[model samples]
Target: MDMTPLLLAEIQFLASFSFLALFMALALALSWMLLFFKLRVRLTGDAGWTAAYRFWVRIFALCFALALAACLPVLAQLGSLWGGLMDKIGNVAGPLLGYAVLSVFVLKSCFLGVMLFGQRRVSDTVHTLSVFMVALGLLLATAWMAAVHSWMQTPDGVAMVDGRYQVYDWFQVIFNPSFGWSLSLTVLGAALAASFLIMGVTALQALRRPPGDGERCAFKTALIVAVLASLLQALAASGMGDVISRYQPVKAATLAGYWHSGDEPELILLGWPDAATQTNRVLLAIHDTGGRWLGHDSKGYLGLDKFTGPRPPVALSFWLLRVSALLALMMSVASVLTLMRTLRRRMDLAALGLFWRKVLVGMSFSGSLLVVLGWCVSLVGLLPYAVNRSINLSDVFSQATSSTLLLSIAGYTALYVVLIAAFLGMLLHAVRYGVVPVRKTTGGAA
Candidate 1:
């Protein structure tokens, strides 16, 4: 197979997946936030909570719709661009994919309408329950998808028979070694991202008008969630390193920038991995920390040279890991600082200075940015193999012509660009108009 076409196909799939992941994260987080707002409305009957729900629901609806739309290309690509992957692992992949689709369809079709449009017609408790069901559906869908991808990263409970993987234990396959960490990280990342978006939007709204009760409630909630999620995400990330070291040492070494096997592996804080020379250039590192972090402890780990098989791209994985870590640190710091200020000063949106507000707006999408980079690190670190040590990507890539692959890539790119632009434009318009006034009936129904 020509590398040109194969690379193009990989790029195409990645492009589609990135778009899907972004909206999926937002949708999942927003669904739960919507539930929270509805629960508050039910418990307190505050019109402010009603206003918050009404405003945020529109954003959630847009995100959920885009997420659903994004799934189409990704699913299509499995059969169209990487049919061999399904051919080899269809026994494992098929059921997971079906479960994800079924969960989304059943939850959305059955309850999403009632949650979004039937709020007035139904009782408050019923509406709140419907919102819970919708959120549960999103959670299940994310778990199934994460299971499938995590299995690819660290395949388990499957035996290779005549060049194809066959599942023997469903539980082992679904709860693979990395599934827990992967799911936790993904969910936390989504929550953190959505929280920042809320903070930024709330701040923006505050700047435009006198800070309302709804804005203050949203800002406070987002700040608290962001603080918790970022801390949890960091811990989950550290634990994930142990999994990578245990199952994929080469990837671990690549991320740690360990070029040579030694008793003491230094943690490269800042450096350029020069593969040609097999050494880090302009190095700034902490000696012995890498060994501990990679779970080697006293026992030294294998370097790139020690791996007999093909190795992942060292520079790509190294820098992506570094950049993502930096981004996560920034998010953590910002969230913690903002949170401290709120606690000490009882700061509302109006009390937040102009500089801080602009900063919030700028960092609103930081969580989404981290999510994309984290995905890149995981996928790139698994280079040369489509399913751990079992299937090579070369074997799975479709034997399409380069020109054809390029054309499809162009088409997908254009479509996503337009869709993203439209989403942002509409989101901005919603923000500009601020919250829609909630009307109350004579019977005290919103």
Candidate 2:
């Protein structure tokens, strides 16, 4: 095989999946935030909270729309690019995908309309319940999708027979060893991303005009949420490290840049991995940390040499994991600093200096960036296998010509670029101008 077409197909699928995942995280985070805002409105009866809800709802709608739009390419690619994968794992994967899709549809058709458009017609309590339902729907959808991907990572409860995977236990399949950790990390990542997005937009709004009560409330709330989410995300990442190391040691070794099995492996802080030589050139690292991190002792750790199967692209996995870790650290620092400033200034956005404001704005999308990078690491690290050790990419990759693959990639790239631009344009416009006041129509004959 030339490998060109397969490479192109991988690129196309990755691009599409990354786009979808980013928007999905945004939408999921925003949905929960909306519920919180709605509850604040009901309890405090503050007009500012209402203003905050109105402002953010627009962004949520935009994110949800883009998420849906992004889904089509991913679904299309399942058949168009990796048709053979379905032949092997469809019994396990098909129902999970359907559940994810159905959850979204149920939310949109039932609760989303009430949450979005029924705010005026329904009572405050009713509207709040609708928001809660919508949030639950989003959570369920995320869980199902995470279950599908996590199963691919661990692949339990399935017996291979006649070239197909059949589920022997639904419980094990749904809650595969990695599923809980994956879901926790994903949801926390979304919350963190959404918090930063709110902080950044609020800061932008403050910079544009005099800071309002609604803006202060939103900024403070998001700051608090960011702090909590970042802390929880760190813990979740640590837990996920255990899962990955246990189930996917090769990926763990690649991510840690470990070449030889030992109790204490050097943690590569900065290096370039050369697979051809199986060494790290231009190395900068610290030793004696891997044992503690991997929860191993006395030469219990397995390294890259322990695996004779196909290895992932070493440099890509190594750097992506490091970059994501660096981003998480930066976000933690930023969150703490913002919290201190918020406490000192008492939610006064105007008191925050321009430098800090710019930092917030720059990091507004950091959560989304972290999510994408994390997904890239997960997918890339699982390379050559569509389903762990069972189905290799060579077996499932499309037979499409390189030209056709290239054309589809180009088309998807263009489409995503436009969608992203539109999202940014609309979001900036909304933040700058703020929401327009709608006239409450009263005394209508029902």
Candidate 3:
């Protein structure tokens, strides 16, 4: 009755996602500040703003470096724990740990160096190159992580050789089912987050004072790019459907509240999920209940019932699947409408109307939160299956020793508590300080 393997797997997954969400949110907030400082520097032609901006970036660079450094060991442990639970090889811990540490240091230090290099000169080309290089490094690292995740989903081109898992054509594993769509969606989501933050910071500056010519010019340019990028992100996300439907139908159906296999499922709007019973208590009006809402006919809808009998909990799947899809739809609509209004010279319409400011913030925070949430629910939801796969209690008991199972779980709990505190503190500070004040300068930029 040692539930150590299952428990450890759950702990590692939860901890990794919790840390990642916190890191991204912090990074986004710092990016917003740096962008604002940079704008002030350009508008006033004052060295003070530039100095502040550089300092902020320096702090960001340092923090990101440290955060990544700390995550490497945890990530290694998580991989090892997951592998052991899956009955995979154990020797992967060494190579993976080394790679994780090396990748973080190399990537973070290189980006920091690029930022420092850009500060000493004023060439737009140099700045552009620096940004490009940083983007490239991030993409490479992301590709690696994506490969690992994709392998977890559809492990292709790998076979157990001589009692060890040997990867055949690593590229095949990397490009497994849904890899393209997943990678594209991930990159687009990152860009969307970055763009939204940029727009928000710029808009906050506009609210503080009427924009000067230089500020106005920069804001206009950024708005166009951000809006376009956001639009592209939505389109890219739509591409996730085909892949999801083909390979991960269960996930797709759950997200859409689609209870069946069919052509063109209608999305579910409001439904109360019962974890104890794999039934979605319908809420609100439903013109197309089963067919359109769950994307399945009467027979297809019955498939959902099959998912619920004494196995990995179907209730969580139903809930998370719906939540993730719902969030995606909401963000897509918000991004499009906001962009259209901004382009029409109705900044107020986009910024003020429909409580867009609050909505924007909510969307950003919710997106990050849901990622962690969905991951947790999914892992927990899968626990029963994992338990079923195990040989016996003795085998499981042996795996948990020296694995630091309880420690990982405790660490995850602590990290999440700290994250909530940090989030609240930021909100309070933002409200108290308000937007940064714009400085009037001796004339405009030369």
Candidate 4:
């Protein structure tokens, strides 16, 4: 299909929100984890824990602010760029959107303020409560949006009422078939991203400051979290892929390039899927897990061949799946080894050599990349139809004007670049300047 005006609009909107959501999810995850640590430290009354908490709070605040700023435009674009989609599903989505903005966002922002500034203003218990509330608000906000996406993927309990979709049962909409798996993947991905970010920031701090007890504490925490999250991420991803296999066969098939639905479907770990020829040239093929991977039947499995309609871009989906899996495995090994070395008492946080420290720094963004790749696979795998077998891209954006489409795309791209750069620049400044100067007399946080 050519790049039509509506298609351009769709791409621009997806790109903008995808970038924003990745960082925001990370922030939400970090916010909760940090707050939990902060609560523990408050009770322990350890200066090391206090310093670490203070330092991370700064980074969390930065991500929260940037993510919030980027989110506004996407919300606006839902109406401006894709009004037709809203118009079709307005009755259902409108209420959810309202709740997110008015209830969740409002509560999140209010509690975040308390978490950040209430340390001195409120009692210790109240401050901790504020942190808990902020985390809860963020979680609820994400859940609401995830519900919307789940409905789109596996729409149920909705019917046409006066030519507009009406919710017959809200429970089905919220707890759709894909809801649990999608939420699990999202939460795990967020944790994965946040852990990497924490590791990255702490590593940078090590470059400027002598390893104080607080710095060591933070580094240890980040390392432990990253390692655990990576392992969990691997499992979560497999479960998520399995969910797709059961609910969305076409997407599942495209993911593994399992084009022909038959017994013993070949699992293509690496390949170039050529759709015109309906053949995937495999680099590594495995038949052992094909049936278990895609189905429970005695036969290998049923997948793409079960569907007669047009399939999504198998090459694109396959490539994304492999790349994501590669990054995930790389992070998993790096994290596990690092943890093992620490656990064996072979290497202390302060004693990690420059080589390993640099490696950790490079892998700090792996979580973000992993999540982005997963999103690409899912979104692309649901191709040809924006709302799965029903509503489509062309149907929604047919009214878009071709003349201004390119301009809109450029506008979103340029702004997102600036937003992302600002986010990174903030982190860079924090890394350079946020470290407390070590003193034997008194080691206060920066």
Model 2 lDDT tens row, 50-127: 788888888998898899888998999999889899999999999999999999999999988988787668766777
Pairs with steric clashes in candidate 3:
255-321, 258-294, 265-295, 266-292
Please state the error at residue 81 of candidate 4 in Å. Answer: 2.8
Q: What is the lDDT of candidate 3?
A: 0.50
All candidates' TM-scores?
Answer: 0.96, 0.96, 0.68, 0.91
| CA lDDT for candidate 1 | 0.87
How much does each candidate deviate from the true structure in C-alpha RMSD?
1.9, 2.4, 6.7, 3.4
lDDT of 3 by residue, 84-188 (tens): 443453332244334544654575576546554544443433443454455455555556655555455445666766655566665676688757765665555
| Whole-model lDDT, model 4 | 0.75
- Arrange candidates by TM-score, descending: 1, 2, 4, 3
Q: Which runs in model 3 stand beyond 4 Å of their true positions?
A: 1-12, 21-63, 66-70, 79-103, 121-128, 203-238, 250-267, 273-278, 284-312, 346-364, 370-411, 415-446
Cα deviation of 298, candidate 2, in Å: 8.4
Residue lDDT tens for model 1, 189-286: 89988999999988887778877888887787788889999999989998898899888888888888887786767788899999888888846888
Find the 10 residues in a row with the least total lDDT in model 1: 437-446
